[model samples]
Target chain A: MKKKRALALLLTTVMGLGLLTGCGGSGSSSESADSKDAEEGKTLSMMCIGTTADAYMEGYQSIIDSFNENNEFGVTVDAEFVSNSDYKTKLTTLMASDSEPDIIFTWELGYLQTFVDGGKIVDLTPYLEEDTAWKDSFNDGMLDQLTYDGKVYGIPTQECVGTMYYNKAIFEENGVAVPTTYEEYRQVCDTLVANGVTPVALASTPDDAWLVSQYIQQLANGIGGYEYFESLKDGTGKWNDDTMVQAAKLFQEEVEAGYYEDGFTGVSGTEAEALFQSGQTAMYYNGSWETSNLDNSEYCEVSEDVSCFTMPAVDAENAYISMGSVDSSYAVSTNCKNVDAAVGLLKYWTNAENASMLLYDYGRMPSTKVELDQSKLSSLCIDVIARFEEQKSLTPWFDRVDTNIGNEFNNCGVSISNGEDPQGIYDGLQEYAQSQS
Target chain B: MKSVFGNKKSIAVFVLPAFIVYAIFCLFPIGYNIYMSFFDTNLMEKSTFVGLNNYIQLAKDATFIKSLKNNILMVIGSLIAHMPLAMFFANAIFKKIKGAAFFQTVFFLPSVICGVAVGLTWTFIYNGNYGLLNAFLGAIGLENLQQVWLSNKNLALFCIIIVVMWQFVGYHMIIQLAAMRNIDSSYYEAASIDGATGWQQFVNITLPMIKPILKIDAVLIITGSLKYFDLIAVMTGGGPNHATEVMSTYMYYQGFNILKYGYSSAIGVVLLLLCAGSVVLSNKVFKTDDTQM
Candidate 1:
């Protein structure tokens, strides 16, 4: 009896300790989350990219806090700031577990399409039709990227165009000007290299493959227009097509010419950004989403001199089209308990006041149709706005349009950079595309 | 009947909680995973049975094959390091150098540090710009040899293997050392009087005595290397076109990155089989005598 009692007590103690640890971990996570969601009657969870150290968090948190206090739903909002690279992995894991946030930060196209097709996301078409003001507030066809078979699954919060963020100070020191065409861009790179500056900063890690691919995508758009992206999607345009081959060949030649920083294949996105910001490189080719990063005094020693330009058209007849897409999007999960509160938060975020705040302070382009108060825009942002207004057309980013195709293309870019034959890279992509169908 | 009931009651009390925990955590997941592997389920959606399609497709997956090759390379590398090299260290330490205890602690320290920290430290040491390896090369007038060690596809897996070998050699060494320490000193003392050299005694007595421990070590080295995740993940992230990808990392990529849960589960089942096969093979190789002879 005594031995049995001892064993039983021992098992009980072990079980009790295990339960205590489990509760403790969850309790701490919840405690840290409490201050973010403290409203009495309503609460919504918002997920976004970047760590706490990022300045974008400050602007995003303020927007959430203001939404919580002033919204009619009286719902407080909690913002979970996942690091940019880790966010997609975490979101996919959460989605798989059916534990996705009420409103998740998502990308458009094939990314959200999986959720939409899986029926894990609520159809927002009814919500849009119910509110004319909400429906009309967005730019025409802005929501199309988030649509699948005529059903809207998300609302894009910002518009991003891949542009060449250049250091004006570097250009002035080198006695060169910003290039506006394929030939001029090449000449600019050649000149920058002669003057001892890496002409472009590009990180080629698989995660940052999108960065390299976007430049090629933009070049492809200039060479063959948006139809190339669609044709590639439909399996009609092979990755080894003349236009793609030309773009790959050009990028390779430039890389060989020392256009990018030395050992860039080994560098990460943060390191590349740092190199550009510190004036080691003459240009940083990235999306407008990085505008906030460029404008930050800490990241850039020459913040005031940092500016951007669209990659010039490779073929003048096609004109310089850009690779762009709606930025971070908001989606309501099927499991959302309060649909109205979620939509209200989305509606509130896209309102002119918040849109303007996002644009002016963070350099995030607004998806809404609201006219920007030019006086409220920074000079760096004003230039990007002008470039966006002047573009002949905009093709949604390849990755956002087709996730599988986009990832393969990005991998192809890395392979091409590593001196792999363009034909081999394209053949691999063609094989992958065939398998997808 | 009473004896059986007595045994049953004691067994029930002792095994009930463990059985319940195992069923909930392990058996349930295995069953669910097998079911899941037959479907196109994305976790949020209704699944449609695809039968053996995931496995059939995996046969043609070049990336998966590459990952399998990487896992095999890791297993071989670990076997070499953990078996012979670790045993050599164990024997040396068991003979009791002046500071054998101190050296054992020093050697085993790296294994105790979390894999993430070790990976991070090695990453810094292998960094392109300011790495210790590059600095050493430069110091020795081999500046031309300073390539980005982790980022180079050809060299990345080898670099990871070196770290794996370093981290766990000490762990296996300690295991073998403990077994060596357990052998009675009477045999060694008698062998020494009979004109046996240290190497001869080690071959005659130590090797025979530690066969069981060697079997256990072989099983551990094989399984541990096959499922190794943290160091590889924290270091290169199986990148530069999946150059250093192992089955475990590729499994994660398929399930998490691509959202192909069925395909990922198929990979998981393959890994389980590989581990089980290795254990049985090791047992066969190290089969012991039935008699005390």
Candidate 2:
């Protein structure tokens, strides 16, 4: 019995030591491995949004691989890809922990502004100012969204605008032409519904609230124009503004009119996209980033017949005004050991050759000027590019403008989709906005 | 060795490691969270002391209030399903019913699955379009009854609660069954000889004997429901305009999504208090003394 007690005591001590060693070993080994990598050469870590589901992931990987192989600075990059849905939470957690990757994929405006406020991002203004040609390469105002307090914090890689993608075969079968006016858009929906087809495929799940909210913003853009969007951004406009109310009412009307697929409020983004791809819905309104997905034969049964046009203007005078913003921007984190190498890698990524490749092959619209080879682009990409060029103004999504108000707007959008009273919803949002200010 | 067992120093040696770990990972976080509840911060930036403002705001915050109500409903729903219903199944199984082992495994299987996996399976089953529930309804000529289970704000929380009930009823049943098995068979045999019906035997011999375990199971069900997160997070994500938002998910939304860490911490403190309160309340309700066992 005494021996058994001694054995048990010995086991307990061993277990305690094992736990202590387990904790200490992991920390020390990782530190050593990082130092070893640093001594070999600068190793920049990049985290971007890309997963197997995204068509352009290959293009993104190729850019990283090429940069790693050919950079003149002897810097190597280790990249990690997270799916878009999980990117924001993952990035924010990393930022909070001060272990953010050297380079991070970021959205413009308020999303990046939070990190800037936290002093977690590297200021890229000096780098941009030092290279006049590179600065000039980006279109005017492209960098403005990422500029905070006169310092640029990110490099914009692509420009995106929302467009209404439709199945040509479905439209033709129903004898409906692409709508060019707000009235025509409603009529088109009516016609589709009368023909026993779902008019639009939309996802309204809480996780995909932005998918529905962006379309509502597009409608608001048509009704209130870019000026209204700007006023909302600067706090001069109320969420309950007449045009905003009209936009919400119209969206609700559309939802009630069976303009959207059945039970769309529960549908996930991918599921809604699949519904349209499978030829069950006539239209899908989303960012041009979806061009590759819509046109990919592997994912879409209607890929060959997929085409797009901008949603028609609510007021014809404000025609071509759309909801859009800079997409796929990269920012250097303050945690980066080699800022220059990271910036150089970003520059290489947005260079003319890679920009053209991304645009032609993956349907990413380059923020920088690149010669378009029309022959190499999908027809949908060409149409989207043409629409981008024709846009009178593009308003960014509300969530990108201000995280607090934008999130409220998205929640309101979900409620609106579920047949809630728009006046009550907007009143609550307006009250919250005022309270925040 | 006997002296070592009686010695406080040896006992401390055995307990200190686990106690230290618990303090670091659990107690410290709880204390830090309470301290954080008094500040307005994103945690990365310097925090401003906000006193009781976060708690005050939580009271007025419509979504938070809704979540509190949802959480209460969840607790009630869980209690109703896990107690009497579980006891009924446990008693049935304890009588050596036919196919007892098969039924036992069938009932307990869901609780063994990961919460996220169960949530995902139920999500597919409750899907609005191609979901099994709707398809089944349609096949029965009740197509009009079909509605998006997770999207209908009125039905969404109840649907999730049903899944939670389905997932854990068997688990509670197993707990109650174990307690039933611990009861002396001689008591039941004596009651039978005294001409007591099965119901009488259950009330006199079974329930009183198992009261101590029931007290534990009650606390588990109540506290478990109060702190529920994974299934709700994986299912609706407090969707359809925050109709399904629970306190835990709201805390996550505030802290992670909106970067309101202080406010999230306040929510955390409230949840912690509520969970602790439920345990106390359950203990009082059960009132089974240790000596009774």
Candidate 3:
């Protein structure tokens, strides 16, 4: 009996120690092994926002492949792509648990600020100061958006702007010109409706509420210009301000006039894009990131006829103001095994070779300056880039600005499109926004 | 043998392994959750102890209140379908009517399939543009009645509830059917000899015998519906302005999407309390002096 008790006690102690070590940080036992692996560099992990279905996923992968082929760090790169809808939540949870990938795809402004404030992201300003050539590769304001408290934390890889993509064949058939003013835009929609064509292809499901909200925000940009957006960003603007209410009212009027696809409230984002791509609708409004989808001949039947223009200003004095921002930024996590190796990968990702490849093949506009190859560029891609250049001001998505208020703003768009009273919705949103702060 | 079985020390030795596993996996997490609910933490920084602030905020939150109401409606919907409707089907099968075995398999089929698959199948069926439901309505010349099935705020939850009703009614039927088969045949023979009708026999002999099982089944249906997550999560995602936001989905949204771990913990605690309250209420409703129960 004494021998049995001793065996049992010993077994339990071993089991308890096993459990304790398993729950503890993995760094302790692996410390020596980690240093040895670091000498050979390591297998670096990168998380990007795109599924296999996205056209740009190919472009992102080729960049990784090329970097692996000729990298100074002896590290091999492995990539993980997450679907757009789930990426934000997945990244945050990973950051909080201290298990995020070495490098992560991020949005600009307040989206990346959450992790910076939590100290899960590396401050890359000193590194940028060391590599001025690489720092200067990005556009002027692109790096500024990812900077916080005078420190840079992420690198912008591309630029995107919301543009109105129209099917030229449908417009020509309807005998309508590209609208340069809000009234002319309304007239264009009326003309398409009279010709028995759905005027605008739009989606309003909660999953794709941001698409609708962006369209509404674009209208507000046209109405109130860059000053209004600055006011909101600086905490001086209200959710129920006249400019916002007016924009929503115009959207509601368009709905009543049947200037949008019928039964559009139920349509999803991809489904709405398909309507324009297949020529079922005259126009689609979305970000420049969709140029690849529009440029594909196999998927888009109206590929040849697709060209874009900025949505005409509601108030002509505010012309050229648009909804856009630095897009597809990358940041090095504090959990990274080697910040230099990760930064090297980021530099490779945004280099002229990869940038031109991404732009020419997949239509992802480079954040840095590069000579245009007209022969390789799609007409739609060129048009979108030109329009992006002409913008007087670019207001990023509200959700990218602040997750809470931006989400509520998206909900407001869904409610408005569903025929809810805009004034009441915005009023409620303002109350919610206040409560959140 | 008697010495080992009767001794408290030996009993503890036998039960210790299982108890330890249960404590680590279940009890510890539940305790941690309840503790976390008292703080205001996003799980990255040092959490601030806010005392009952999360619970108080949940009470005042319109979205949370909407989710609570949605959960209650789901429970009610499940009870209506899983209790009487399921019982009625079980009776038909118990009567040994023609094709009873075939009908049993058909009714039990959906519950065997996974919830996510069921949700996706129903979403395709409910698709606004090219869905079967819309196409069928159009075929029957009821074009005027055709509308978006899952996107309409007023109708989306009802549509999902109807799918839920369709999917689980059969599983509950099988449970009741098993209890029915356990009943002795002699009671019914005596009832027939006494000139009792079929309905009379069912109401007295069959029902009284199965009352205990029915009580347990009611608790199963109620708790299951209250904690339902997969179907709603895969379907609307508590959307069209959170028209179908049940407590489970709302809790997931708060915890994962919004990064409010404390608030979601409070939601979890509320869900637990609701489940416990329903179990007690059900026991009271089914109270009996019969020793067999």
Candidate 4:
């Protein structure tokens, strides 16, 4: 009887401890370790976007390593790298829990606005004003996207515009040239299909729905120009506008006509890119950040033959309008123990030497004004830079405009790809937008 | 020892630790979740109290309705697959069929592999262009039927349901088989002696003997299907325009993707209630007296 009572006590205690430890696993351990480290000195923690598959990861790593070795503050920075696809979910969860890193890789505009509104991100306008030289180093209007209500919350690292990357060898083999008009683009796709070639490598999976939506938005830009996008952003536009429906219909036609590879809707972004890199498809449309992947011999089988052109306009008058915005940006989280160290690290990352290294080595276009050294750039990078210079106005992705409406728009894009009517989809989106307001 | 055991203080001491842990980890979080469901919150900002507004909006939300329907379909699909089909396999093995041991291991293999791995494997099999399914169809001169399985919104859910069914049939079979084995051998021997054939013996001996275990297994299948998440998340991600969205995945999307924590918590509440309701309904339907078991 005594043994039975003792056994019951032991079992209860063990189960209780198991539950407590499981529940507290993410808390007590990290808190004790972090406090211990802080007592010694400052250790700035950062979370940035980089994955093994990204060609620029090496450049990103080298920059971080150099900063860790040479920073004058004697502060050692610990950084965690999350892949781009999972970064948003990870960051939001961390922010909600008040466990976000000191510095975070963030998208500009609406993506950062939520955190700014929540008071989870530190306002960097005062810091910028104090360092006039550092503030002026950035290009004109680059900081505007990261600014909300006259307060800057992030530092821009790179700039990107969408470009149509094509395999020159495939084009030569198929006897097709870069189309300058929407009609000519359709002709080229038709010709490619007639010759048994997949015209575009596109991904329409849920995670990569943004990629599909960007293409449709690009098409809409051709039909309605920069003003259409601006109107949509400012809430004066209806998603069910004629130009938007037309673009969706046109995209649907392409999908049905086999302009994209079969089973493209199920393909992931990386897989779609690989299809183009392996020379299975004639062309691929994505952001200029893909310049590195297309130019890197290790990633692309036909790297030498890969070249880019601005996507042809649906209306020739709106030729230079494009989809693009500030690319990589880093913001200081309000939870940081040392805000100055985090800012110092951002400055170090955006310095001219590092920016140039990233530009020349990884094909990342710096947001700062750096003198172009054409001789060192890959041909694909040079073409992308030229295309960037030609854009009349660059509209950022819809998701970066407003996460709520933009996410719905992405889902609508997938539905459009799956043969749903554009009119009903857009009507629902308009209703959702109105309801939110 | 008896005095110690009999003491109320000792009893409280023995029970307090576990009770405290459960209250903190499980009970408190549930209470907090219910509280948060009435507010519009991102959890980072000051949450605004909306008082049943989230639940009201959920009622009119098409995506939520679609997801709820999908979850119901999943429950029905799992019930059909895990019960009758698993019983057939279990009875076959229990009767000492040829290579029963080998067949059991083979059938049980998929359930042990991780859900993510199972999802990924099935994705490859369903891929349209170079997938095994399409290739097999082509070889058999049925190329017209080779559609993109997961990309087709109408068919995506059924494909996922088939995979779920395939993955867990053996798990339920093993449970039922164990219950069948627990029956006295003399019952089957007596049935055979009474001029009962193999089928007769099975219906008389195995069927009634596994009733209690079957009831438990039914509850497991129903609740497990209602909360199914990882497979859908890893495979379709509730896409082809939300055709494959289940309750759990939609809850995730609302909570994390769009930062509508209040709305998501409402969905979570609905899910919890439905699961509890199902357990109660199943208990009543499968009610067997303790003496009978």
Best by DockQ: 4
TM-score of chain A of each: 0.89, 0.91, 0.90, 0.92
Question: Which regions of candidate 1 are displaced past 4 Å?
Answer: A1-41, B1-6, B290-293
Q: How many clashes (backbone atoms < 3 Å, residues ≥3 apart in a chain or on different chains) does model 3 have?
A: 0
DockQ of each: 0.39, 0.39, 0.25, 0.43
Least accurate 10 contiguous residues by lDDT in model 3 chain A: A22-31
Alpha carbon lDDT of each predicted model: 0.81, 0.87, 0.86, 0.87
lDDT of 2 at A157: 97
lDDT, residue B86, model 1: 91
Question: How do all models score by TM-score?
Answer: 0.93, 0.94, 0.93, 0.94
TM-score of chain B of 1: 0.96
Alpha carbon deviation, residue A193, candidate 4 (Å):
2.0
Off by over 4 Å in 3: A1-41, B1-4, B7-10
Residue B95's lDDT within candidate 4 is 77
Give the DockQ of candidate 3.
0.25
Worst 10 residues of 2 chain A by lDDT: A22-31
Tens digit of lDDT per residue, candidate 3, span B1-293?
A: 99999999999999999789767755676688899899888888778999999999998898999999999999999999999999999999999999999999999999878889999999889988888999999999999988877778889999999989999999789778877877778899999999999999999988888787777778777878888888898888898888899998898788777778888889988987898798898999887657863
Comparison by TM-score, 2 against 3, better one = 2
lDDT tens digits, residues A347-437, model 2?
A: 9999999999888878888999998777898888888998898898999988888887898899888888888888888999999898777
Fraction of native contacts, model 1: 0.46
The TM-score of candidate 4's chain A against the true chain A comes to 0.92
